[model samples]
Target: MTIIAGVALLLAAVAFFLLPTAHLNTRSLVRVNGVARIVPPETKVAGLAELEGLQTGPGSMLDLTGDVTVLGAGAPAERTLSGRPLDPDGILPDGARIVVRHGDHVLEAIRRVTVQIPYETSVEGKGVIVSLVRPGVPGERELFKGVASGKQAAVFTTSAPQNAVIERTSSAASGLKLAALTFDDGPGKFTQGVLDALAAKHVPGTFFVLGSSAAGNKAMIEKIKAAGHEVENHSWDHPILTKLTTEQIMRQISRTEEVIGGSRYLRPPYGSYDAKVTAAAAALGHKLVLWTVDTRDWETPEVGAILANVKAQTKPGAIILMHDGGNNRSATVASIPVVIDWLFQQGYSLTTVAGLL
Candidate 1:
């Protein structure tokens, strides 16, 4: 009995010492996404969620533990982990390699933006008369784009652009020695006297008459035409064409054309024009006429100043501006004979606007 008890005590002492030594030598190694770590013996790791230093989300992971592989969670979406689908909560064994794969997914975001659309311009006409047909307007559009990876594409256009149209004349050639004497706001009290002055000089002139004036003085218009003068259109009320809308502009020009019958020219009041005005004139088959020499006769300047203006600015292909009837024109009528004689003495042959062109 004493020997048996002694043997049992020795066996207990050996077992205690051996157990501690074995426990100290044992170690657990785990590899996460190819990174290796040593863990305490008998350490329990419950799936990828329980793993330390792992970012867990709606994705996939691979568990290669002891010749067994498991692909866990999520498919091929944005930021998805690549592997066969498996249970993410399954326990992991020692010496296991856990591969977390972030697969591709479509990321979406919505934003509103304003984009500018530029207007285009086009030009027409080849005369010494330039006009703007249409002022171009810019356009706008909204787009919805889908981006995959790093590429972008246009979705659609919300508004289309409006283009501008311009009409212009080529530059006049030099040294032509041609001059056009033009009268505006005519068929008034002094119109006959002005015509008498031109007839005395045997010169041809262009008369831009108001529709209202021409309507009242139809006989005078025919008489002026008989005197070999060119009668053309001046606006009915003579408002600034640029300030008027397209419809108003058309009315102003068309009414004058209707009254004047066969006139082919339009001299906008105050020498002002815009795209709408020019387009309206062109649509009525009228060419715009502007002056090179402004006598400022409407201001009733001195006859000498008016003559000086004519002489100073007259050139080849010159269009001289004079007013016969807008206001009291005793000065204009008086200056007419003197101006015509001076031009003749300067070796200039006065002609109509059409003749000058």
Candidate 2:
């Protein structure tokens, strides 16, 4: 072989041997909740605020904002970099990544720290119930191999009260596409505005009324019902249901039933419920109604953000969650027509929760 050809072969062998070490020097193995992943080397994040912003920004799915626990691999795990324990800033070591753990707060429902739910279903069928009594505590993310046991069990019907019939319809069965809009914690000062918006569009929705609010705002609740909308239960006062005993939960539910006269459905406050809460609600002759699309209107985000969220997430058979009470809901009121117009353009017929079912 020519000397140049021999030299070229020798150089190729040297490069092959160095490739693994070069890769190890530039990439990091990150394990989020024990699932292995990779991040670029030197992917340092400083301060909780920055970390949270990065996690929730466009195109990212991990959220580290709420009550988080951080753990660092190697020694000196207690080190602090940005006013909080541990650090995410600077180059991560080759083959090592920091772990961030936080309670996963689903927008539409309560989530168990240990359980995996495949889809939305009634509380009883899931079997695993999470109570408000034990709130989530942020911990360091650890390696976890989550196993989804199987599909949800079949619905077991019992003798619910005669009045406890939640309306459910099948658009597919009827050859129509339908959606539902639901307002929670209502009968507040802003409710009339919401009603006015819906009225302008000639649209009907479901209102999950709070018993405490209903007693004081009977006229508002009546107005909601009289306007061709459905009025259902959202507890007497909004409390985390899982935090209360069965008796307390019953009281919260039953008192609202008394004020509303009777309800075919119940919406647990904060979307927090477990088996016990569902059982208590079942005895009261009510079915649980949770939302599918959340506007996060309570945060009083920019009106455009509210409208954007609804526009982006609405789907057939979806229950769109908005609020009529608990804050300045003018933004929510503003979003109504925008959402309705877009949905109508998309050929979706808006209806109450019962209508969607």
Candidate 3:
């Protein structure tokens, strides 16, 4: 064959050998760092990698502990994994998952999340699919060996959240030496219990509705407003304001304003807020109210825990933080009667945030 014809033949041969019969999904990103070498569904690798000895021959014996490469589509890029050449057959195309091991060193690339956890990562797609590969021993956080989409792989990292602690406002909200027992992220399935408790004690509080939650439970939001309580801005989505830009911060709060209407007041989620978030609220002519004391019922579910937090935190004019929504708020609701009776007996009147400020 002529040189040109020979090259064409070789190209055809490689194409026939490497092409996959399936279409690929190419969304999501892959990042690799740290001392641990692992492949996730969001990473990519070439067949010519100088690791696991797959660059030249398909017969290279892999350690198989971390090495999970299989024969698939696309040309393998030339590279090195530790110190061995990767085989062409050992290369994965887009959406392929592979794992490799070299001594104490283990590596893998999963290109997609087998299970997409519904956390506040991004507001895209319906949700994530959780995938289970090999079976594991009962009840262990199964190390997600990998996530694979259509064309890449990555070793997934469980991200730990870093939150800027919100500064406590020292002064209590004004008026009547009244303490506003504000419950945020509420009007959920259990909110009626909180309402009943509050009503029984003849105390009125505030409910800062999250637009997302209120969308599904509008009546609850309406009920709180109707029940002599204050409805304020807690954002459409309960995101940390410190994580958002100016416009996003406004959207977070304003979207809730739209749902709740121009009523008044704003509470940052997780008590997380700053000047920018406060600015967004101010530009819209809303008061940025920070909690003077955190009842932290979201973390500790016991009624005594909730009561301890309240007693330790409450004072004259204190704006107490409690929750009506976002996960199980039963314990918070339970503390209402005891706290109301105690506070009222102690001459602290229970009033809406609007009544106080």
Candidate 4:
């Protein structure tokens, strides 16, 4: 076969192998063989369904997520996700849910509606708040309360508000080709080595230092900051925040903040936190910072593996998780320069977690 024809056949084979499952209703991503697939959160739903008992036609108004915007029931339009145009008739991804009503009859089958609410306050609020359309339909405000007037607040229906907020924000990352390198449980013997590697690259990273560790390694902590790196909280003893009481959680964060002089960000140990934990962090005016590309360097994996893991998963606006503490991190130290070189070659700007935001 000619080279062009051979290449076309190979492309066709790859597409067939990677085709998504059809008929799966889970999480609204592009389906292939009934299995959920990853799609951008902003992708619009192809067709809007009428309420089960509503007399409205295909043009019936639909409330997508919590945004009071226009949704029409017409032929599908091609749209992009992660920079690629999705199938025109693609079903809505699972990032959001919708609801509609006709008179007293309500048609709501969507799950996890709370994903639509952005928590501007503590996630531990006694009552969750959500935005809803005043009237289920346009011009229907003449019938009842002024809900039809515009957007209004309602009680969110979900048991895990923290998870919903996390899901919502997960897809909200910017399209910038910048990534943040974060070192957790730091101020250790290998910290200086890691810092040296970073210095050679002229890149600054965020170090999630432990309170107890920082207390003993005060000079190292100071050095990290002195070298132009950001210091953040990683709890007092690296306990799981989800299992701790409110007071205990407060202490973990407060003690770290005290030792670090002060911190505006917290990285919960093991990346675990429930609503209560999130609220506690918020109450202290600290933003929760989680990683996107985990180097698994804490496990002290093979040095080559550490470099490979970072190079494979690094992406735009990605937060790369690594470690500068917890026993031998020589592998992590050695991997830094190579990873930084690869990132630079790939056109990524390395910065602190706060800078990525």
Q: Which candidate has the top score in lDDT?
A: 1
Distance from true position, residue 296, model 2, in Å?
Answer: 1.0
Q: 1-357, model 1: which lDDT tens digit per residue?
A: 999999999998999877755366467677766788776665544434455645644434322111112234434532112343434554345666656655523233334445668777676764456666676777886654332122234545678888878776632532566677889997799899898988988889899999888889899898889999999888887899989987888888888778878678899988886566777787878777878889999874689999988889887777889988878888888898898888778777777887765
TM-score of each: 0.59, 0.53, 0.51, 0.54
lDDT of each residue in 1-357, candidate 3, tens digit only? 599999999998898779853334444232122123334333336522543433332222222244434442223333333335434445333333333433322234432344322222211221111111211122212133343323333334454333222223333344346687888876687789988998897788888778888878888878887888778878887888878887988777767777776656677777665545655666677666667668788899988988888789777777888888889888888898978877777788777776665
Q: Rate the local accuracy (lDDT) of all candidates.
A: 0.73, 0.67, 0.62, 0.67
Q: Which candidate order results from sorting by lDDT in descending order?
A: 1, 4, 2, 3
Q: Higher-lDDT candidate among 3 and 4? A: 4
Stretches of candidate 1 above 4 Å error?
1-128, 132-174
How far residue 175's Cα lies from its native spot in candidate 4, in Å, is 1.0
TM-score winner between candidates 1 and 4:
1
Model 2 misplacement above 4 A: 1-176
- Candidate with more favorable, higher TM-score: 2 or 4: 4
Q: Write down the worst ten-residue block by lDDT for model 3.
A: 122-131
Instruction: Give the runs in model 4 whose Cα sits over 4 Å from its true position.
Output: 1-173
By TM-score, rank the candidates, best first. 1, 4, 2, 3
Candidate 3: lDDT over CA atoms? 0.62
RMSD of each candidate? 10.9, 28.0, 24.6, 34.6
